[model samples]
Target chain A: MIRIGIPRALLYYQYYPMWKTFFQELGAEVVLSSPTTQTMLSSGASRVVADTCLPVKVFCGHVLSLVKECDYIFIPAIRSVQRRVYNCAKFLGLPDMTKAVIPESPPILDIDIDVNKGKRVLYQAIYKLGRHFTWDPLKVRRASIAAWQAHLNYRELMSSHSLTPPQAIEKMLGSSEVEPKTHSSHSTSTQGTIAIIGHPYLLYDEHINHRLIHRLEQAGNKVLTPEMLTTEELESAIVKLVGRAYWTYEEEVVGAGGHYLESRIGGVIGIMAFGCGPDSLMMDVVRRQAARLNTTPFMSLTLEEHTAEAGVVTRLEAFLDMIYRRKRKQVEVCV
Target chain B: MKTYLGIDVGSVTTKFAVLDENNELVTNIYLPTQGKPIEMVQQGLKQIKQQLSNGADICGVATTGSARYLAGVIVGADLVKNEITSQAVAALQYIPQVQTVIEIGGQDSKIIIIRDGIVTDFGMNTVCAAGTGSFLDHQALRLNMNIEELSRRALDSQTPVRIAGRCTVFAESDMVHKQQMGHRTEDILYGLCQALVRNYLNNVGMGKDIQPPIVFQGGVAFNQAIVKALREELNNEIIVPPHHEVMGAIGAALLVHEEMVNSQNGSKFKGFEVSEIKYHTSSFECKACPNLCEIAQLSINGQVLAQWGGRCDLWERSQSR
Candidate 1:
């Protein structure tokens, strides 16, 4: 069986289920890279230029880890997921970047995905990708349908139950009984809700973020993420905040940010990679919206490869203290 | 005779404050951290112990600052709070109507927005220390002048030259260029202050509202030039409360006082004799995972008292066992 490698970084959180299902249905075994760690991040950081965003660096690291484990590495150049709504340039050049950085790696399976080119081009690209493993077009069609179903189901699980992508993916692939592992002490003592608005990669990668969601959960505060919000809700929020959304993942940052700020949540924290152009602009929009609203408290955390966890801990602790204090004051007034 | 003790162990300085039963300041001690937090904490404790009246009982203790966790473990604190909360609490206590707090410590600067005694929003400098007290200290050392002289000289400037403050490296070069250009020492010093204020406002105070009655505190509060620059930029009065340098410790002390009264628990303070406990700390690379986290251990007489710094809390939890 042809073993296909998938680096569990970048759009892995968004498209892993579909990719895994599609490859498996094509009779190819899918191998995922190991979870991120300090060594992996450092190696990835070393492979790329110093100024590249952290997620891309992490992607390089993941790709490097998979060189010995699989026959071919799948790297897609995803330009735009919506008409006129584009991805970051780094993502557009991802396949070429990986090929350039690690010339000794296995043969790469590359594809260009641009929704702005229309639906037929997108389907044709997937079909061409499928031709590598199988000759039958009917088999390819069936596999694509199955992949679509898996993707929809994965997204539904995330939105319906407020599960992080990894958690939802685990539940979908394993047993539905898989529950989000929460600390025993915090299982029943949720004091407030905190909305963390950021890209799915930054929000779910425990290593890069210093286990941000786990830390918040351990502190007895419920966490909400962009994955947990619906597309309509996010789109409507974007419309309300800036009259439109232009970035591909604007829904995750600006839309979720504007919506969360207007809601009764205790606070909103925006996390962004240090050199991500799209995130910097979108996060700024959220920050400005938070400032204008003056209702939900906002804090922005910039993630870099070499940032110490101590800085993140201090900010989180202080932000939580602010939230709890404000909640207590509100309780006092009501009483 | 009951008192609450607050210890703030920062990157550049460690401070200790003792508050009487009525929240009145009884005694305070400030000393440079000198790149040795444990020694500075012990030294500050020793100084504060000597200054306090014999019968003043330390009934509660709290710790705050970057090294709050380490200090809490060493001193047996009842609360370990972040510097932001401590600063805000202290600011609110000093000026009841304070709406904003601009605190520039040794290696960090923060702007806190408070409304109705609640911290509604706050920001800390991210991955940069260009406008902090350390930069000023660095420049002072380069110019062969003490920090006090730097402050006094900055006040005497009539025309200040603009220096780029976005990066400390650039700022130093700009200062050197201005000096060679024969600009007066006072004008150059005040220019650096103005540049730092601009950096602080643009970075830490980016999107937050800065309404007056603003309170400024922290080690950098002692710089009259920075305060004057802040006043000019905001066109609002910047209030520097009494004991601004030790406000974090005072705030920690105030928090512990409130906590002890409400919880009805005996103080967890290890006592002033904590100065003589003969504590030591060491770190090792943790090989339990690929992350290779550097774990720190605190010990007394070769017995491990606490452990921390591992990405996983394995060593930290093992200490309790």
Candidate 2:
């Protein structure tokens, strides 16, 4: 069986089940690199540019981890997830960056996921990828439809169950039992809810965000994220800024942030990469919207290779304490 | 007599405070950390023991500051909280109507915005030593005077010269240029204070709703010149509370008091004998891979307590219990 490697980094949470089902249907064994670890992070950092945000560096590390394990490392050039609004430069040039950095890398299988040219162009790209395994056109079409169904199911599971991207992926892969992975639920303050708005990569990468949702939950506060809400809810939250958002992730974060603000969740934490372009602009929009809300406490955490866990914990505790006190005060006032 | 103990182990200083059952201050100790947080905390415990004796039994203990987790493990704290919350809590206790808090420690500075006795917003300086107490300390050393004398000299300035305070490196050069241009030492010192205040406002205090009844607390609160500079900058009356140097410790104690009251179980405090428990820290360079992460292990009596501070993480972060 020809083993095709997939690094569990950027777009992995968003597109993995689709990619996995596509290749598996085409009779290729799909091998995913293990969940990100400290080894991968340091290795990735040593290979990437100094100013690159943490997720990109982590992606570099993931590629390196797959160099010796598989026949071809699949790093598709994802230019556009939707029409008009293209991916950041990092995603567009990931395959090239991987090749330039890791001289001893494996043969890379690339497919341009650009729908800007139309639906035929997208099918052509998928056909080219399928031809690497088999020359049958009908087989490729069947695999493509299956992959699309799988991707749709993956997204549906997330919203219906309020599962994080990782949890939903785990359930789909049957790597874990199809059960909701719950954290501390015995908190004294049910009103102290926190909405953590960030990209799937940052939100799910334990090595990147350091299990931030877990930390918040364990600290006697309930946690919420952008992926938990439906598209209609998220869109309605940021209807005021319809044409302003350009990036897909930015829209999700800013819209979710707007919802959390109006919902008056105890707090809204906007996690962004230190040097990310879209996230920085998105965070500014979220901050401005939060400022007007005034009822909810807002915090923006910038993640980098140099981020200190102690410092992050300190800020999180302070934010939680503040919100907790405010909620308690409101309760007292009602009495 | 029941007492609550609070220890704040910062990067530059270690502080301990004791509170009576009524939440009134009993005694406090402040000492330079000197990169030895464990020893400083133990030493602080010893001093507190001498001051209070065994007559007043410590019922609950809490830890705060940068080394809060470490101190919590060492002292067997009932509660462990971050410095920002601790500082805000202490300030609220000191001044009931305080709307803002300006906290400047040696290596860090933060501004906390409060409304109706609750913290609304906060901003912390990111990796900048400028406008912090350490920069002023460095400048004072260059002037060949102690911090107290420098504060006194700055207060005596008739005409303060303007100096840029965005970066410590730039601020030092600007001060030298002013000195070369025949500006008086007192004027230049006060000017540096004003510049630091300006930097604080621009960096840490920016975009926040800063209002009156601002309480300035931290180790740097003792500097009358900085307080005066803050007053002139904000054009609001700045009140420096008593025992400001150990406000983080005081806040921790206050929090522990609340915890002890709420809990049905007895406190987790390990007792005053922990002051004599010597801690041992061992470090070894691991060249396992190209990363070469040097792991440090902290222990008491040759038993590993916790491991941290590596180029890479050999340090598995366990869930906080």
Best DockQ among the predictions, by candidate number: 1
Candidate 2 on B13-114: residue-level lDDT in tens?
Answer: 999999998889999999999998988888898888889966798889999989887888888899989888899999999898999999999899999999
Model 2 scores a C-alpha lDDT of 0.85
The native-contact fraction of candidate 2 is: 0.56
Model 1, DockQ value? 0.82
Worst 10 residues of 1 chain B by lDDT: B312-321
Q: What tens digits encode model 1's per-residue C-alpha lDDT throughout B123-234?
A: 8997789999999999999999999999999999999999999999999999999999999999999999999999999999987889999999999999999999999999
lDDT of 1 at B321: 42
Residue-level lDDT tens digits of model 2 in A142-208: 9999999999998889889988887788788985422234442456756467889978788777667
Error of 2 at A64 (Å): 0.9
Using all chains and alpha carbons, the TM-scores for the candidates as numbered come to 0.97, 0.91
Best candidate per TM-score, number?
1
lDDT of 1 by residue, A1-335 (tens): 99999998989999999998999999999888878888889888888877888999999999999999999999999898888887789988998989999997899998899988898999899889999998898999999999999999998999999898988988888743223343455658787899999998899888899889889988888999988988888999999988877888899999899889988888999999988888989998998888787889888888888678989999999999998888888899999
In CAPRI terms, model 1 is classed as high
